[model samples]
Target: MTDWDQTDDVGLMLKKVRGIASDRQLMFFACGCCRLVESKLPAVRYLADRFEKDAERPMSRDEKWSILSAIGSALLGDIHPILRQFLMGQDNDSWTMAAQVASIGRMFEFNGAPESLEAAGPSIPRNSASQAQVLREVVRNPDRNIEFDPRWRTDAVRGIAAAIVESRAWDRLPILADALQDAGCEDDELLQHCRLADHLHRPGCWALEYVRETPERSSPNPGDPV
Candidate 1:
C-alpha cells in the first residue's frame, strides 16, 4: 500500500513513480503528489526541469484532477500569476497556464469589466464552451494574442460565440456577428455566429442572411431557430 501521507518520503516515491512500468494507479497517485510538492517548492529552475520531464508522460485522470484542484486552491489567494505560470510550464502541455488564463477571466467577470471580458475571450477552445462562459471577462491586453491563429481560429471563434449566446449579452452581439462575417471565418464559426444572431433576435441582418445567401451549407443543430 502506498502511503499518501508520507510527505517526507516524496523523493523516494517519485523515484518509484518513474521506475514503475505496470502499476498505473500507483504511478498516477505518485505523480499527482509530486506535482503538489513541485508547486510549493521555491527553486524555479529545478521545478522547471521537473515539469519538462513529467509533462511528457500522459497524465492519468486522477493526476489531472489533482493538479486542477491545486490550481483552484492557489487562485483563491493573492498568489502571483507569474509564479503559477512558472510552476505550470511555458509550453502547450502546461494545463496550468491555460487554467491561470481562465482564472483571470473569471476575475474580470466578477469585476464587471466588459472590455476585460472581451480580452480574455479567445483563450478557450471551441469544444469547451461551457468553461469559456465562466471566463467571459475579456479586456484588451496589448501584449497577448487576442486574435485567433488561422489554424485554430475557427474553433476559438465558435467557442466565443457559444459563450456569448449562453451569457445573453445582447450588447455584444453586434461585435460577435461582425466577426462571423469575416472571410477568414471557418464553417463551425459561421454556424455559431448564426446561432448567436438567432439567440439575440437579430437573425436577418448579419448571420442568418449570410447563411441563407451563401452557397455553403452548415451542419444543422436540431430545433435551432434561424
Candidate 2:
C-alpha cells in the first residue's frame, strides 16, 4: 500500500521503492524508508537535502550518483566514500539493495559510531539497553512476531554486516550465513541485505589502506544542530 495509509511500514515501504517507476515516486519512497528507520544522522544531511530537492524535481545522473554515494558512506558512519570499483560491478538491483541497507545502518548508528565496540572486534555490542529499548516500543496485542522499531533492529544487523565483510578473509560469511543455514532466520532477504552492508562497510581490502579508521565526527547529541 502507499505511504498515504500511514500504516505503511519499512517492509512495505522498501517493496514500494523497488517498484516505483517515476523519479518523483522513487525519491518519495526512498526518503520515506529513511524517515521510517529514523535515518536522522548528520552524515545524511547532504542526502536529505538532495532528496528534498528531488522531491520537487527530477534527478540528473550525477545527482543520483551522489545520493547512492552518500548512502554507502553513511553506512560506514560517513567514513568511506563509495569507490568507483564497487559500483562498477553492480547492476541496478544490487546497488539499490546496498542503498536500502545503508539507510537502515545509518539509523542504527544514530546515537554514534559505536567506535569503541567496533575496536573490540567484529561483535555487534548489542547491549541489554538496546534490547530493552526494543521491548518498550512494542505495542499491546500485537501479532505473534511483530517487528520492533526499525532503528532497534540495527544492533544485530550492523554487527552481522560487519562480520560478513570481515568474513571474506576466511572464505566464509558466517553470522548471517550460519543463521540461515541452521534455519534460525526466517527472512531470506535479510541475508542479502546484510551482505550489502558488509560490502558498503569495507568495499574491498585495498580500502583498508586508506579511508580514515573512524568517522570524522560522532553523531550529534540531543539539542545539537543537524
Please report the candidate that would top TM-score against the real structure: 2
Q: In terms of lDDT, which candidate is strongest?
A: 2
| Candidate 2 RMSD to the correct structure | 20.4
What's the count of clashing pairs in each model shown?
Answer: 11, 0
Model 2 lDDT tens row, 199-221: 22222221111111211121332
Colliding pairs, model 2: none
TM-score of 2: 0.34
Q: What is the TM-score of each candidate against the true structure?
A: 0.20, 0.34
lDDT of 1 at 112: 24
Give stretches of model 2 more than 4 Å off.
1-9, 32-40, 77-89, 93-226
lDDT of each: 0.34, 0.36
Residue-level lDDT tens digits of model 1 in 12-62 = 322332222122222223233223333343232243334334433565545
